[model samples]
Target chain A: MLGTWSDGPTKSAIVDFVGRVTTEGPNYVVPEERVAVFDNDGTLWCEKPIYIQLDFIVRRLAEKAAADGSLADQQPYKAAVAGDLQWFGGAITKHYQGNDTDLKVLAGGIMSLHASMTVDDHAALVGKFYAEANHPTLGRPYLNCTYTPMVELLRYLETNGFTCYIVSGGGRDFMRPVTSQIYGIPPERVVGTAQNLKFEGADGHGELLIQPALDVFDDGPEKPVRIWSRIGRRPILSAGNSNGDDEMLHYSGKPGAAAMRLVVLHDDGEREFDYTAGAERILDHADQFGWTVVSMKNDWTTVFGD
Target chain B: MLGTWSDGPTKSAIVDFVGRVTTEGPNYVVPEERVAVFDNDGTLWCEKPIYIQLDFIVRRLAEKAAADGSLADQQPYKAAVAGDLQWFGGAITKHYQGNDTDLKVLAGGIMSLHASMTVDDHAALVGKFYAEANHPTLGRPYLNCTYTPMVELLRYLETNGFTCYIVSGGGRDFMRPVTSQIYGIPPERVVGTAQNLKFEGADGHGELLIQPALDVFDDGPEKPVRIWSRIGRRPILSAGNSNGDDEMLHYSGKPGAAAMRLVVLHDDGEREFDYTAGAERILDHADQFGWTVVSMKNDWTTVFGD
Candidate 1:
């Protein structure tokens, strides 16, 4: 089913887990409990040059800075105006290194980008950007940046009994607009960091306004908590490419069946970006837990595919 | 399909909405966007004697007060120890009257009941309570308290290619364990008030501990916001029984297709408690918006049915 995947242990592990649970035996899991969660960036799509959401929000902040002198003085806004991907990348790298002082500024900037607008308006803005924008490094439409093998894996699982969900650390509203078209996952199945929404009922009409507040930063340890809160059952299979997904791997369906944990390693600088700055911890656990790690350079015959 | 419902405007409205949307025409909605959201308490089951979650939590607090003298001295805990349903009822009644000073205190007590415990522990407690507990006034097992007509309605909609979800102001974990068996709604489809969870990964095991804080109260205006956040699509059909559900009905699919908003009015004094203290605002909304008001006294031939 996963035609883009090379014949390897990583693909075999996924097949083995699906077969064990779907077959009639002790390891058999009911169809109702077959939950599959996936991280959006890096795992599903390209995040190396920068996360797509970051790029979208930066262009927005940069435009605002060009008009407003006050906004131009801000650190991230200044960085945004200059198109300094390294500064944003460093903030993320510092966060994985257990320092979030600069990451908080980055998060605040992201939140401010959508505050005070209706969800529909924000969704339309994101829709416009996704349609017109292209990956800076890949020179391809943002929607086509999703990994070929991963998309095949998602379709293959759904072809069986698994209901796949995108549980990214990106903004929930940011991902909701395009997820259905790109990943074949519906908006209801996408879980991510959220902004507080306030219902404004005035002049005899009700509209929900986005509040400027951080609802949940759904990364790292928060992933497991949010997954359990959104979907009460544990996931039978999970996939990710960074340390942020470590807790989710541990929280997969356990003690009763064989759970598959797929970790994708970007080691093909020729085809895709190669770096392991934020994935050290997850890589260690992959070895310790005997999880199947997919070498992007070797496991796939192609990078992006339909 | 809705056999329990007598031939009335309410039943006709539901049938008409479903027919217009499911059939191929200018008014037709695709099956993927046919979302239905339902309020858990009062709408699906009896909430007259008390909300089931309140009953469960108060009993736990009363037991704690029996041993802890400090707990017995507190206002709500003392009321819990004394089995004063009036105090809890009054608190709910006042909140609907635009006063939540006492409701906040009551909410604090509710949150504290699950604080510091793992989600699995809390779910197990709820499971045990639902198994053995009976409605204080209805004199039936808590699991069997669901309204027969509502169950038929849920099943009817599902039979017509609709995805049903339970969105409530009650605790998410509290409603999740039993919604599947009682309402044919799975845990993943149940959205409600949430407690922040802490991921405690120690001793080679990961457990989610419930933090003593209210994350989001899925009531009143928050209903529309939570509904959008969880589902990302406006519901074409919504059912509720209180003021908290008014916004949900307003937020139902609009500007394009026929939307069905079912407001259940408990006015059967013989078979159920007749009260409009908390439902006054919603009753006014039903009239103003031309929403269908399902009178339990006239619409149903039976209240609780399998």
Candidate 2:
């Protein structure tokens, strides 16, 4: 049972949807077809003050600046560390806004930061960051900030034969370390933006080196594209909370399939931050699209686990 | 328990490896980490005459040429259809051999064949091809030619809580349809080469269109890189039968991990084929690398299922 979910219409909808898909009848989906996908960031955990991956990137940039001092003068690096919203939004959004040159530059900088290290080394570094990094407002480790109801929902779905996946905009490698422990999802089930990796060494003796380049951006409409290419199945259920997740949710609820789409609305200021942020359009279109909107204030008995 | 495996060192090795990894002991792996990867073409099914995907492409090319006679004069198309070893090997191997321009051209041709189709449409096309296509030498549908012993191995691993994956060099979409039925491996567990896909249509309503572009070519060294990026975990066991699988096997047997690597040697001329082809170097280096070599003639009591 979803113990963290409050007694409300949102919880009832989820329960009914799962029941319809799992019970024996014409509507019952076979176990193999019961695939459920969840968007990370705000959908699985808090992304309020700032996206946690961005927080990790900012910290890494600061470390680079500390070591070299020359990096501090870089345009994006200086603006990013100072938390300049104008320049940060311009530079960062340019990549997401379909600027090829800007994406190349940003990808180059991010990849170059850890490209020299093998994947194992990079994972170890990310593990260290997750252990030390704390949510700015919550003052707790970022790992502890995952939504309790969503975590319970993932387990409930899995218990009913659903293969749950975290299809996030965050880097795939960055999310793999914590997803298994927190969401009970394995590394292979976590799909996201990726970097090209190189296989180096002789025959029967080789290592995969993470290269300084971008592979797939896995955002916006790219979410559905990736879900199709990587997972090769239409997910019967999907959950998200931002404009980036809009297309993915739409793709899940495509015509002819008995799919359920849920959007988490971050409207509980006392328990969590209250802001529509980039999710304004998604919230507005929920009723039109027949998507269930889960209001944190009304639908969740608990926000974050202790 | 292994009805199709002959009494041999290879069979014993496989049984011992599974036992060590499954039972509670110093070498025991947790159920969550019990990942096993297999190469699809020769290891799981037949690939002697040619790769089944290449067969599909050639047929599609012929259909296009019939509609518009211009394609018959094209260099790659002409050479591919006539089974011209020189141009066919050069053009096709360029993608595997890492020639960017040739890969782009080949990818363009392959992607163009199905670019307009949605993911579901393309999958349906592939299904129709499988229903009609027959193995050149075996006189049976390619799907039915899957190795009985290997199929048994997959089920055995699954019964023991091991997650099996088909890490093939064939197109990911091409392999997804039959993998579940033939090998009991699901689509998400099938990682292979991919093409860029596009999300088409209006907001809250769209389909993923397969595009004419190369995403990742899962061959040679790319195998390990993809395994790491996609699976995010090192497989405890890996099986393959060609040089393309060299890097993947090596990555699976990385230091400190209790890993087992098996190479299927297609030396049973009566039951299957006889030559090593691209697997020569792998067969030669198996001893030095501690990889088990499975001889179809000696290790498998039965090759194909009834």
Candidate 3:
């Protein structure tokens, strides 16, 4: 089923792991326990140049600035449109210094951009964005930049009775609009960061309005936290690429469970961007934790469908 | 499939709704959008003679008091053991009066009963509790006290490609241990209230410890908030019995969707306890909102498996 994966150790390990869990092997897991979780950004799709959700946010901010000139005076919005790294660096420093008011304001602005809109309306808008948005470096549609091998692996897992979930750090609403179309995973199975929601309108005519402020920031440790809180089961298999996913991978690969963790190393600069960036720590953790590190250059026969 | 459901409007409506969603009917819902959510308490299982979780908490508190006499001296603990309704009423009234410290302390005590235990250990404890615990009046094990007709409905929905989820007010961890065994719903599909979790021990050798405070209180309007946050989709069908589920049922039965809402009414005093303590508001909401009300005396042929 993972035809895009080359005949290598990574492919062999994945197949062996699946066989051990699905067949009557020593490590056979029950069908109910066959839960596989994947990180969305770099593991399942390309996150190079910038994360896709950030790109979407920037585009939305620009659109808002265009409609209302007052938004152009906003610090983060102004800095974001001009691609000022210094502003982001200062914001990060402030965040580290325990002054997260600016960060919250920025996040609130980004979140509230679509506040009061029904979830379906927001999803339609996101769908339209994905339809026209292209990867900055890849020059293909952003959705087309998803890893073919990973998509195949998702189908492979599902074929073996494993329920697949995308535990992304992206906005839950942002991902839900496209995940089912791209990865065949339903919206409910996709876990990510979310904002507050309110039910508006009268008794029989209400709509769930998405609020602007951050509710659950599902990144780093919160990924595992949300996974436990929402899914209510520890995944038997997990895959990720960046530092944000390290905790989730660690939680998946905890001792005493016949679990598998795979770290996708973006090494194929020709087919995809090859900068490690925030993923540097995971390489060390992968080695120490006996997690399979998939070298994208050698292990993947195809990078993306495009 | 709903063998225990009598040939009533409730069962017919459910069957017709499933047929419309599954077959090429006018309201044929796509398989991806076939999400069904059920409330665990009175909707799926027996919630009479107090909620099952509360009974478990009181039992655990008693066990703790036996081990340490100091806990017996605690106000809420002492009040709880004596089944003093006045104490609870005062605490609730205080909560309504904006001083929720007492409520928090009681909840903290309830949550902390299984604190520091690994997920597996806690699940095992809950499983043992269910194995030995019998319904106070029914004399059968709590697991067997689940609604036979509702279990059949769950199976029927699954058979028609509907993904069923339990959106319970019970503890997520508590329901996970028995949901699969009793309802054929896996732990990952069960969403409920949870506490903060901490990863204990060294890297690669840690267990996720359930903390002793509230994280997501999956009740009332929070139900829809959680459904949107975690599931990332609106359920097409929802079932619940209490006023706490009013918003969720409303969210499910939005204007533009072909949705169904079923409210279970416990009016079968002979087979099961008859009361509408917290669900009276829902009964009125059902009449006003065109929601189906399943009368326990008329709609169900068998109340429980026992």
Candidate 4:
């Protein structure tokens, strides 16, 4: 599965580790709890400059603002409608601080705008956005920005009976609609940030509807903690690309029976957009912790799904 | 595991279905997509006059009310504090809705409740809660109220490579904490209703803390809808007790596969709580649609953990 690591350091280490854990080895074993976790955004797919979900939300907010005209001048949203990326960045943090009248009002606006469509409709919207929307620096479809080595690693873990789960800071509802076809991981297994939803009955006939409210952000160290809280089992293997995934890697590396953690470092720019400029904090920790930091340029023969 | 199904119509039908699904006979095989799901409360456990989690929440609420001097004149809190079982039924639905506010407040109040404690400390809390709290009707530890026949059915499905998951309307986080110990099912395999939780940095370090919030109720049809949205993989076997699990059973019996949906009718008031007083809506579809309805009184040698 590790095509780049077929004869190199990255491939050999993983191969050796797998061999020792299986029945043929000296300490041969198959622990009933063989769980693996992955960070979705940058680790699995393209998450640089902006997350895929954030891009979707921004586009959604702008579309709503354009059509309604009522929220036309609502700070960041107004900037979003005017196609101003700088103002959009400044307004997002303010919006998250409960700055709006009701978080649900803002969330419901997005949910209602998007919820009427089926999964296929939503997928088409996302697919269209990805094809046309360039990654500021990568200058390509967001889907084309995925790390090939990490995808190979995901498949490798699955071959070993490890139940891999995506624990991201992205929206659970948003990802649930598309993750299965894209990642080969089903919608149910994708755990991420989620907004609170309400189910209201229509005329007592028990019809279901989605109501949105600001709920939780599953990011940073929260990744691993939420992993344990939601999944109960600690992952024996973990992979991540940013500070958001640091805790997950640490959690996987905690002194245990069979644990391994790999941190993906974006050092390749020719094949994929490299993040050597802004993600210094993440790069520093990867070196400090003695964890394997995978160099994109040196590690893979491809990027994205071919 | 239809141990007591010697001659009764309910028992014979259950046995016949299990035989068909597992054996190599003419009626043996089932389509892969004919998935099954089971509800935990009342269907598997004794959620009579009150649900198990509600019992914990109410007791905690009364303790807080008593401490704050609010229970001195309040009807539900005072009755709860005084351990009046008869008054509990009148307050069940009211307590279910209003309890969320108190639960959110209480959950928000517990700053480092879990972080400070060791694993043993947490297990002790569960043990203490189980020991001190008595079911309103059963007069035994709430854990002891679990139905044994259902447990056997769960084991039987696992042996047949029919992947099973606990799809309930209870809090996913709360049920996850002890489900592995009690049900032999890990947290990832258990799906349930949940209060929204935000993750925060723990102890100013890289560690994280999960905090609860006010949110949606995942009962009735929402149970199955969430199951399909979250797990993606549907079950070929399904079971439940109340109207909450009706959709899940419906999902199982769809035309795609030779599926079986079973409903457990709690008919033994002496051994278990009876549903005759109309505690929950028992649908007519179970019989009309050819589902195996197991009468609790005639199906098992025991009711709870032996």
Candidate 5:
């Protein structure tokens, strides 16, 4: 069912689990209760060099910097204008290394971009980018960079009576427009970090303005909270590829009820860039908890869906 | 398709809208875009005496008061212990009158009740209430009180390739368990006021605690904000029964795209309720906007689905 997956233990484990759960037996989970959540960037699609969302943001920031000299002097805008990929990726790395100072500045800079725009305007901007922009290094469409094995895994789960959801730390509004076509998941099924939405116009004909702040950051410990809030049911299966997914992976598995957790290891440097910068903690836990760790180098026959 | 709806303009209008939108023509909307949102309280069920969730809350408050002497002296707790339904309903009335003084007190009392438990425990309490509690004034089970016409309307829309969601001011977690069985809308499709959820446990084995604070109040103008955040698309069809639904109804209908908004008027004293306490503003705008006003006396042949 997972066509891009090389015949291996990772594939066999997932297939066996689905068989037991869907069968009318002790492990049977009703369709309504069969919830599965997957992290977006590194797991479903490539987040190498930097996140796809970050690339989109930096490009937009650079354009604004070219027009406004004052904005060009700002830290993120300056980095964006110069195309300093290290600055953006380094902010994330610094956050993981117990320093959130750079990350806070980076997050604030991102939120400021949405402050002046309505959700519709922001979504249109993102939609235009998705339609026109290609991956900088990969030289392909942004949608083409999504992992083929992971997409196949999602379809296989759906075919076996599981509703798959995209739970990421990326902007929810940013991902909703393309999630359905790209991942076969509806907009309502995609839960992520939310922007502050303000209701304008009194009694009728109101618009939701995106404020310069995040209402919720769906990462680390917050992932479990967002999952419970949005789904209202514990997921039967969860898959991710970073330290931020540790809580979600642990939350999905229980002692009695059969559950599965999968973590993708980005180890195929030839086909795809390989680095464990953000996934060190998660990989360790996967080993200790006996969670299925899919090695990209050995387990996937192809990388991108195309 | 809408068996419970009487043969009238209200029924005909809804049917025609669905037919035009579902068929292949200029007004046709793809199944993915056929999003429908419904207000849960008065629109979907009997909210005449009190909101179903509010009634559930009063019962729990009364139970808490019986055990603790200190809590019994409080305003809402005292009122709950005395079985004072007027106090509970009046707080909502005060809110509509633009004086949120009592509503603030009433909301704080409710939030305090949830602060002590995890989501699983709070859900169990709500589930038990749905299973065992009866509507006080109606003298029937809580599930038995949901409007037959609305339930039929939900099914009819779903049958015609529309996805229906419950967007209410009531607690999102409180309504989730019964929404699936009572209204044919699953837990994930239910969007309402959210209680803040906190994740406990570090790297693995996490539990989400229901914090004693509201993350979002999905009512009034905020209804449209919540709708956009969750659905990410303006609904083609929306329904509600009170002033809280004004923005949502207006938001659904644009200049051209073809949308329908249904507002239920509780003017049938015999079968259900006859009142205009909280619906004065919405009813006034309903006439102005040409939004279809469904009179319970004339539009429905039955009340409860059973």
Candidate 6:
């Protein structure tokens, strides 16, 4: 049997709309061209004081700096290890300046750092990191901080024949390596920020070059543009937790027969990180634009994996 | 019910291995990793003296040149319209060389080439070209020249839960426009040669920048290497019709609990083009490989769509 919606006015309204557009029940509809896109970071998971991936990158950078004398002298590298995250955050881009050295050196360094390890080993490292890490403000296990209601929304759309894709500003490949297992969305269906890679043969085996420098950051407006180019179609439904996904929701809400754009409002202080203002990532846009505002506080009975 | 394979020395060996590895009656069923990779042109469909995509490019060039005088003076552009198949063919790479035109330009050019036309229009144009154009030697409709048995083989593997991907030397996006409908595979799952694409836009709605050059060509050893990079794992089953796919087959055949590589041998004369002895693509590495050879002459059945 299909699962019931954990009751509430906001949840009921959103679920009812999704149900109408899905390929079954009363509405039993949607054009064959219908598509849906979702943002990954705060909308899909938890991004409070800082994005989880940025933390991973900082950690990776710290390890590299400790091992490599040359890297230790670098601005972001040195700062990352010293726990000076402010300097390490997006500051590496300024340091790289005009040359391709940052990307080349960083990606190469990162690959060499973990290239020899098998898939199992990589998973274990990630698992250990997640277990020990804590969000600065929330002071909770990072892994247990995902937005549960948004996940169910994703499932509802998919069940209705919507081709759901994760379009985020985070690393595309990194998200792909684990999203399918975690969210039931396959790697091919996920698109996000990417590092350039090249093909080569190493030690009598084929390998790909994973560059460290940023390629495309699927943030804000870039979200919708990348969606059109990569997906070749506009999505009929879109959901996001912040301003990073604004363009995506706008694109999805483009003039069409039927469309839906939802902004997940973090109103639940007890269950999840509650924020009233967040630099226009989510709250500001919700009031300005007439989009479905899902109140995490009132709409969800659960916020993370139980 | 499982389909029957003719009793043969080689066939028996392959079937026995699969039988032992499957769920119903299995010894060691390696679950969730049954990846299969395929070579699109010549293997999945038909590629004779020239590729189908080349014709599309040439036609598009002709149309573009007709509209823009700048293109007419171009070496490749001039050669294309004059019906100088040889000169035009030789300039295939040159057309894409250093042409850092943005996605909008590339997409606009592509969409405009056959603008406002229905799917049938596109299909008919392709069919008309295939019907009239003559291969360098085969002298039959390109579509009529496909390997019949191979199509069955493709579906056969898919039925067994093998996720088949088209890993070919052809343009990845070019094939994506049509292959899924024709071959029953989705666009996201297909991987092939690519031109560099740039993302642009406040919301990522920028045009796809097709560099006037090839970004990556999925051919020769690059086939298997690209497959691993894109898919992040080696295929358990592989099929190819030429030396271009030899690396892929070899990679698939590498010792695992159960692995299989099948090579399609174009040996039929009366039913289709039979020129294996001098076939430049598949013959080069035929002697060194230990793959299951599906002989067109000996293999049961038809050769093309009736």
| Ranking of candidates on TM-score, top first | 5, 1, 2, 3, 6, 4
What is the lDDT of every predicted structure here? 0.87, 0.83, 0.82, 0.62, 0.87, 0.62
Write model 5 residue lDDT over A1-306, tens digit each, in one string.
Answer: 788888989889999999999999999998888999999989999888788899998998898788888988888999999999899999988887789987898888888887858778888999998999888888899989989889999999989989999999888988988998899888888889987888775444556788888888889889988888778889989999999998898889554689999999999999888888888999999988788999999999999867
* Tens digit of per-residue lDDT, candidate 2, span A62-121: 677678778788855675567654554455555545555654555566887887678888
Looking at model 6, residue A266 earns an lDDT score of 73
Candidate 3 — which residues are off by over 4 angstroms?
A83-105, B83-102
Each candidate structure's TM-score, on Cα atoms with residue i matched to residue i, is: 0.96, 0.93, 0.93, 0.72, 0.97, 0.78
Cα lDDT tens digits for candidate 4, A1-306? 677453678667677766666656544445555677888876788765566766777788888887888888774466567766654433333343435443334455555566534333454676677557767676666655666667677777778766778888777666665565666676657888754433332211222233444445677666765675557666777777776676677666334455666777777677666775334555676677566667677766677655
lDDT of 6 by residue, B118-144 (tens): 322344566566446555565555555
For model 6, residues A154-203, the per-residue Cα lDDT tens digits are 77777667788889877676676667666787765677876544444422
The best candidate in terms of DockQ: 2
On a 0 to 100 scale, what is the lDDT of residue A112 in model 4? 59
Fnat of all models, as shown: 0.51, 0.69, 0.48, 0.26, 0.59, 0.06
List each candidate's DockQ score: 0.57, 0.66, 0.54, 0.24, 0.57, 0.24
Ranking the candidates on DockQ from highest down gives 2, 1, 5, 3, 4, 6
Model 6 lDDT, residue A259, Cα: 66
Can you give the lDDT of residue A264 in candidate 6?
78
Give the per-residue Cα lDDT of candidate 4 at A294. Answer: 72
lDDT of 4 at A143: 58
Best by TM-score: 5
TM-score of chain A of each: 0.97, 0.93, 0.92, 0.80, 0.97, 0.78
lDDT of 5 at B220: 86
| Reference-based lDDT, residue B36, model 5 | 95
